[model samples]
Target: MVEAARALFVREGYHATTLTAVADRAEVGHRTVYVRFGTKAALLRHVVDVAVAGDTAERAVAERDWYRAALTGRTLADRIEALAEGTAGLMERAADLFEVVLQAQATEPELAEAFQAGRADTRGLLRRFVESARTDGLLAETTDPAWQEETVALAGQAETYLLLRRTTGWAPEQYGAWLRRTLTHVLAAPLR
Candidate 1:
């Protein structure tokens, strides 16, 4: 049902998509969707969450191998590269649906709140990474971890990926490489 909702929401846009249509696409009864998810907003939120989480319940983004590599990398460049690689994959999976949510947020108060909440959550994750880098002495003495965290969060956003990939015709690999280089230059400790 979540997959079905994702497809329909992407294809039809938020206002155009209906619980009945989702039911039809999933080959389930309308009442079943209402029973399972309770509301259209709830269903859409679930779909977005699942899509961002890579459609899995077993592990979170922080627990994923790529994320672990980013955290455990021996050098700042290696950490940035791993982080970019993981972010690229996640953006590829979630960018379109994330755009949908962003657009819908203008008209749906609940979706607007959800969008802000998601942004805050992402910022928190980036802040944690920045804190870890600071703890590892991989950041310059002048670097502000909060500022670096916000910068990295904005730089690694889905909109940036969508712009570079869809507008500028950069492939995912190119995007990842550019992100890694850019972030490395911005966040890496200076060479003595």
Candidate 2:
């Protein structure tokens, strides 16, 4: 059902997609969809959750293998590169749906809350990354950790990702490389 809804939402948009269409695509009953999700906004939330986590599994992003791999790198640069790749992959997958959220949130109160929560969640992840790097002495003594966290969070945001993709016509790999290079520069540059 989540997959069905995601596809429809991406293709037909949030307003155009209907519960019945989702049910039909998923080969489930309409009542089953309603009973499981309750409302379209709730189902959209589920779709974003599944997209962000990369699966329907009950695992948090921090617990996922890719994210853990980023933390386990031997060098800070290595870790940042891995983290960039992971973050880029996530943006590539979910940024479109995030665009949908931006468009639909005006009328959808739940979507507005979800967007705010998602931003906080993104910031929390970036904070954790900053903490992990600092713990390993990856950050320089003069570099502001708060600045790094906020900058990276903003750099990796869905809007930025989508804008770069739309304007520069860069592929996902290009975006990932840009992220890695940008962070490397940010980490090395003195920006107090």
Candidate 3:
């Protein structure tokens, strides 16, 4: 039932979707849905959780290449490139579910918190990546761990906007090159 509601929610959006619609999609009676979930809000939360979990899982799996490349001295530039490209691929692949979550957050403040949690998780992951770079002496000694992660997060947001809006013809490699060069100035250790 939850799965059916999620599909309908994605297809028609939250505001337009109703319990009846969800029930129809699930091939269950409307009374059953109401009895099981109690209210539309509960079902909405379930749908959002399910979608967020899926997105997180997919992104984590896709990022294995990034961890491998980074650990292998493949070049921060190259690894960063893989990161951006992998993110874009994930976003495009999960566009429907993402769109549903996006729309839900527009009207539901509670859903916004869930979305922020997702962002925080991404930031935490990037912070760890930055810390690893620092420990490896790849980044400058003066760089703050927090700031490094923030910069990466900002760079990622820009890359996402570009990819989603088709703002340019950048292939992932092109974007990654730009990011690495930018970061080199921002975080690279000064030459002795």
Highest TM-score among the candidates is held by which one? Answer: 2
Model 3 lDDT at residue 129: 62
For 1-192, candidate 1 gives per-residue lDDT tens digits of 988999999999888999999999999999999999988888888888888778658677788888888888998877887888888888777878887888788888898898888777777676777778889988876535666778888877777787787788887678888888878866874533
Write out the backbone clash pairs for model 3: none
Angstrom error at residue 116, model 1: 0.7
Q: Is candidate 2 or candidate 3 better by TM-score?
A: 2
Off by over 4 Å in 2: 190-192
lDDT at 101 for candidate 2? 90
What is the C-alpha local distance difference test score of each model?
0.82, 0.85, 0.63
Query: What clash count does candidate 3 reach?
Result: 0
Q: What TM-score does candidate 1 get on C-alpha atoms? A: 0.88
Ranking by TM-score: 2, 1, 3
TM-score of candidate 3 on Cα atoms, chains taken together: 0.61
Q: Model 2, range 39-114, lDDT digits (tens) per residue? A: 9999999999888888889998889777787777888788887888888888877888998898899999999998
In model 3, which range of ten residues has the least summed lDDT? 53-62
The true-structure Cα RMSD of candidate 3 reads 5.1
- Model 1 pairs whose backbones collide: none
Please, what is the TM-score per model?
0.88, 0.92, 0.61
